[model samples]
Target: MGLIAGIYSIENKAIDSGRHLDKMIQCQQHRCQGGEPVKYINKQIAIAMVNPLDSIFSEYDIPTNSHNPISGLYNGIYAFTDGIVLDVPKHKIYFESNGLPMQDNTCSSIVAAAYQKWGLDFMLHLEGEFSCAIWDEKKKRLVLARDPFGHKPIHYYSNNKKVYFSSEIKGILDAGVNPGIDLTSLSDFLSLNCIPYPATIFKNIFQVPPGSLVIINSLDIKIKKYWEPVISVDKTISFENAAQMITESLKEAVKRRMMAKDAFCFLSGGMDSSAIVSFMTEVSSSTVHAVSVGFEEEEENELEDAAVMAKHVGAKLHQVIAKPDSFFDMLDLMVFHHDTPFTDTSAYPTFYAGKLGSSLTDVILTGDGPDQTMGGSGHYVFAVKNNIFANRKKTFQFLSGIGAGIASALSIDPTPALFSKIHRKLYRQSLGPVHAAYDIRSYFPDIVKKYLCTKNLYDVHSAHNPYRHPEAWFKQAQGLDDINKYLYADMQFYVPDDLMIKVDRMCMAHGLETLSPFQDIKLAEIVNKLPGHYKILQTKNNQIITKYILQKVCENRFPEQILTKKKQGFGVPLEKWLKQNNGEKIKEILLDPGSLQRGYFKGKSIEKFVNVFLENKGDYFFPGPNAIAGLLTLELWHRRYLDFI
Candidate 1:
């Protein structure tokens, strides 16, 4: 919700550089705490705090009645232990908060508390969402930290004399930092559609990972992770008891998120969203407001399903129809809004859905984490197979589980070709421990494989690490018969990076506060430990399905047709749209001389992909259109950031 920037000079005084920092602050001033900038300058020290949205205050809440007297502070940085400045000297250490606190502590409180408790390690305890920095006046050092989920961005640039940092990548680049793309990261984007942790588009510039802090003194830089997501157990509970427990926790999760002056919920007619909205309606006296997006009548529509739920819950629903015209218009806007190459075509409709919610409420609540937590993906079966294979000591049961899994995975009459592809690919890729290493390595683009990973990021991805290990990912899955490793990977990577990023940017762009009930600290823990059967149950037709408990919850409220519907997530029809007007523009940027000239991709290979896309009857929106869209989006972003043409 905000941007923070600071500079620490190693040799000379930071006088002129501090003034330069002010100009840098102006560029992201829109992100300042409601557009306010706090500049503290001393002889050798300079600090600047900029918040783009509302700051967090524990004692104060937005008056629900709208008639109560205002509290102590509206929007201001409360300094707990003020740092000293010498003779109007520039202060390079600055901290600011707008959306949510990373930890329960205030910026000054955490800094002061950290200095008090563990000396410099106090940062380990703080939680919430924040981007903060500190300038060491005497030693001429700069320190920065970002919240664990990376909802906030912290970009920094350091040379010989001064170190400049900010919450936006563009802001730091604007501060005279090199904006050139990191040659090593090109493959990272092509493979994963995002720069991996601790890396960014720019070479010298890097993003501080979530739950991490960075310190720089005279170019001696250090980055450390202070937090990670972990699943805890409540071993005493039975399956039925756990289901009841989850329901209760989910109720409270919905309740806490209702803490808004005026709130809206995204209702996608899917199990996850419908469950949240249903809970919200039951808890609130007034009807909850709901927003949804559907493609123009013909292609894939969810309006009827959304309407059914809305009627049952007595909520007022606003639906946005993604007519062909609207799809292209939104596509253009999404390219700019994302500011990067994102392959998730669903991002466009998701953006529109958020925009729709923004106009109606000051805050919007979403159901995002459930699918990941509950084993909702198609790949969960393979993970379960691998788990059974690993655990089976007896030949009979082990062989039986493997046969069942392979049969379940290979059953062609019922399952989609995509499901088959995912299952075969996972099993093929995970044939032995070595292929797991190869799978990890193949996840990156060839360009990155060749140039960037000299240290072998794949090899570094731990065998025991849940983030990379196929078995660990399998164990994390909640499905009954099949384990969804793709769901596991999606939760760890996609949920935070693409979905959460989309929500944060779209909502904050208009100053609307958005919260995710599924992100509740406790509910996530419970879901993480639930038995896979309750998470994913076998359908009568034998396809894997999600949220058996949730399905039962809505059984009386909605029909089977609605609950069993295919998951057509809020996404754009990018492939279909690209074939229309200015489609070639996307192709041009993707295959631009720049991507080739810069050696990010092989020009011939890029052309071949485009040719296949144009010729084949493939899933255009998934890979074909997505690759072109992402590449073009990045090219447009480069123009916006660099050429400004």
Candidate 2:
């Protein structure tokens, strides 16, 4: 819910760079823990912190990066940690952590605790949604780190001689220096909806992977992953012990997050969200408030389901009526806060939900990690299904060749060509790497791929860009089965980069703090390693079930109807909205010649996609709608970031 930025130089050069830090901090001043006088250590290091504007302890603006005996800026280390720290010393150290020890933990105490326990490795046990940094006075080094789940982000750029770090990417660029796009990451946005670890949308600048720490001392920089999303079984926990284990873990998770004053929940009317609401109601001492977003489009609306959960929990439900007009209208603001474009139709709703919830409380618990941890995504099952038919790849390829040969000789033109294309696609999909399967499922078919025209895609760096072919991520899931491998990718790539990015930026944009009990490190470690089948089940009646263990735990908690209910997650009415007014909003933004002239896309190709979208044709690629959505987001981003600059 806040931002931290600072500079560390190789040469012990006095930095007049307070200007850069000030400008960067000002960009995210909403989380201003107020301004502090700049402190320099031996003229080589500088540190700054900004907390939320509306924090209760507004007077404690200048966080504690304590002064040592040698000089006031001891070690010249400056630190900013967001999210309440669970444990710290009883008495005050560097900066007053608002009040009494454990109850009101400040970023100062959190870092101070790390200094005490792990020395430079403070990020390891420093749990919760936090991005923290420290300057080791003795070693004359700077360390930057992020939380295990990456709900909070920390990005840094090293220009060989100096290292620049920040809580958001724009904070680094706003210093009047645009590093330009990361030439290697051109297709990352199109395929994954985000850039992977150690890489940002901008070049040179990089994000710290979740569960990792980066250290810089006189330009000798090293980034290490202290933790990874590795799934391993706990031998003590048997199949019969799972239910109670899940119950206890949830209880503790809720207790930790609900520690804040006046906490609330966002009820999505789905199992994940409703379960959070139900848990909070039982564990919280006070009345828990719930917020839900309702769409005018009946198919996209879930107010009734939310109401059902609200009544069950006896919580007051406040609904935000989300309309297409409002969602589109908020694009400029979203791009400004996110500093990047995301096309998940749910982004706008998540934004509106946070805006609504911010009115009720500063901290809201969301259900984000269940699908990632418990193998709940339908894609996991689809990957499994693809594997089942993998053995038929060569057989299908031979038949496909025969069909094309016969059609060519008979003078059947497109029909034979189309058959060959489909056959090749199936063969590739069935036997391709899991990550390849994952990407292709979301990729526009190659026939329509000419629509993308970015210069970076054809450049020399393209081959090295792991995103072009994502075997790197799949290969990392070495020991897991096909389903778990896909789940691991979802956890490592999709959850942190795409889903977490949306939640963090949108919620924080409104000055609200979101904590996910499901994403808690301890809870994730326990559930993620469970047997893959325990997470997903194919019932005797032919139904595919996800989060199998969780559903069993909630079987008696929610109504029977909820147990059998369809999976209705947080989403927008995009398909229907595009059809509204003959897709005028889309036409006005995406089909505009000026948009195509940006050199990122071919004008005619976009027109064809738009026409196909309007025609409601299913033969086109699945990602076509998403790609079309990204085009609007990109154009809007240009208006706010690139063009404005």
Clashes of 1: 34
How much lDDT does candidate 2 score?
Answer: 0.69
Measured by lDDT, the strongest candidate is 2
lDDT of 2 by residue, 503-541 (tens): 988887876778888887777777866777778877777
Q: What ranges in model 1 sit over 4 Å off?
A: 10-12, 15-19, 29-34, 43-46, 50-143, 215-224, 232-235, 323-336, 381-491, 531-533, 538-542, 549-562, 591-598, 617-623, 641-645
| lDDT of candidates 1 onward, in order | 0.56, 0.69
Candidate with maximal TM-score: 2
Candidate 2 — number of clashing residue pairs? 3
Candidate 1 per-residue lDDT, tens place, 379-485, comes to 45444444433433345544544654574445442112555445434443334432333243333322223222223333332222222333444455434223333
Clashes of each: 34, 3
In candidate 2, which residue pairs clash? 31-51, 33-51, 75-137
Q: Indicate the residue-level lDDT of 286 in model 2.
A: 85
Off by over 4 Å in 2: 32-42, 52-77, 87-104, 234-236, 386-436, 443-447, 454-470, 618-623
